[model samples]
Target: MNMIDPWGSSIIDYDKLTEQFGIKPFTDVVDDIPHASKLMTRGIIFGQRDYNKITDALNNNKPFATMTGMMPSGKMHIGHKMVVDQLKWYQEKNADIYVSIADMEAYAARGISKEKSRELALNEYITNYIALGLDVTRDNFHLYLQSENDDVKNLAYIIGKKVTFNQMRSIYGFNNSTNIAHIYTPLLQVADILHPQLKKYGGPKPVIVPVGPDQDPHIRLTRDLASKFNEEYGFIEPSATFHRFMTGLTGEKMSSSKPKSAIYLTDSLKDAVKKVKSAKTGGRESLKEQKELGGMPDKCSIYELLVYHLIDDDKKLEEIRSKCLSGEILCGNCKGCASELITDMFEELDQKREEARKIANTLLK
Candidate 1:
């Protein structure tokens, strides 16, 4: 089951909470609830969203920008696809896009070989992001590495001046017990939200970010700092959409390190098939047991992948859930079908990745 960050109030424990609404697991929870689209839409802020207040800003069309980034710690995965798809949606809705390759953040977090990792991260991110259909020239998108941008540094310093050690500690849960570096690093993230646009974009504009729930800390910190800065200096508007968390095949939050939990876009058909076939499930052990006791589609990680990431049709997803719960489809075969579907999807994505590499080289240069 997916867990919520205790400090994050807006985060709903999905695997647990979905049970309350009779929205069985492995079913399309989003589709079952009628008004859920509004309350639980892709861009709705997970916590503390003042929608009535923000709508005026959005309607006014006051210069707005959307930003999202990736840390090139490893190969890009379908988990990354979730956010990139969200970014493209916002761009289509008319937000100026600023995508960052977060080299500095990776160095701060991972302690990898700084220079080498930085280069790899940049190349990998540029290639994949462009492959995912980001058009730099046509869309007027800004693609840059975080460390290379002096503007980001200046913004970090400016934002830091307003934030006190106490405030940072409270927001980040840092204490006398925590490291000083950890307390301060979130500020760079806050700066990432606010800087690089004041001179160009000029004033408060709606910035929607499509990010997983774990990084809610970054969004929360950025929103708090932006509000403080706005009250003091009357600066840019800060807004974001917290996409619901997605779990890996093992029923935990998707992590690149655990190959079983996530499907990397670069994974070969064989690897994809092996991982999905072996993924954990929430079904009964025997056919007789499944017939008597319905399978828990809600808790099945493989089912969740098919619903959220693979199958696009609402009707078909429901049919699969009913089949699983009723013992019509065995878990092994169900997993095999999902694995094959995902493998096919990635095979197409890999071809596009090659095309993206060629274009990304030109843009990065």
Candidate 2:
């Protein structure tokens, strides 16, 4: 049995997740989407469940929504930017955007105080979200702290009525020793996902959650709960798109808690460039060996930085990949390019975050 701990930062085997967990490949429906994001086109979004609903809504110009949450336990990192990118794409499609700050979960799992969670959510997460061009001020964008949302809290209690402790244990690998708060927090997530379909928000419509593979357990539980309560709430089972986690600078899973493994959105431009330059690469041991065997872009963290964030044009991206694989571009050259790109990006973010901080301060009020 493959146990996926939502709170754990271990690496995930995405193939096993799809084959054993019934997540359909995103490529199966890629051509169906209109103006799919680069993440989708580049195959970063690997698996999905019921994404056809979203594609249908996109094609027909019907109402739909995109929902995602942030657990404000640490600084926001570059890996977290992928979620923002997906949300931005949904916004462009005119889908209602729901951003939930999971203060309750942060408290339950990480022992973070509600006040501290709120502070981090606004200053670290939301500020960087705006800096990344999420347009939080848009009329269709709904940002709320979970602890403050009475509707979500109330719905979570009601959701708990239908779920048993045994079910939670089975899905989350919970045991007798697990804290009750930690065990119950996932119900709040279900509420976060389904609350957008409430009558006050709008009648039931398609909703999509973009997440990493580790979050599949939540997606599965939410979908089941949505069906069990469908008669009362008219809930449409939420859809999800699972994206690959960004490779860390040291080639492990990128985690905010591991400062060396990730580049925080708030990092100084010099530090950001330094991290890129020092990142692991898939280069051969020597120039002579590299010329004979070629570089492996697939295993290079610096190459992943370009593919995932820096480069946008497919043709240009392909050229870089081809050069790397053909031994024409060495690790030093790739690192130089990645470092320049990250430096430019951080400089822009530095300016935008000042105004974003002001806007973020007012968002939760």
Which one wins on TM-score?
A: 2
lDDT of 1 by residue, 1-365 (tens): 33333224243564454443222232223333223333244322243232333344345655567778766777776767766665665565556888777666666666555565556655676676667776666554887777787777678878888788876655556668755544556776677777644655555556655565556567767767787788655655465555565667777767777667787777787887787888878788877898678787878878877766687676888898998887777787678779778877877768888877767767656
Off by over 4 Å in 2: none
Model 1 superposed RMSD (Cα)? 5.5
- Taken over the whole model, the C-alpha lDDT of each candidate is 0.65, 0.93
Error of 2 at 108 (Å): 0.7
Which stretches of model 1 miss by more than 4 angstroms?
1-48, 51-63, 175-182, 231-233
Q: Give candidate 1's TM-score.
A: 0.81
- RMSD of every candidate to native, in Å, equals 5.5, 0.8
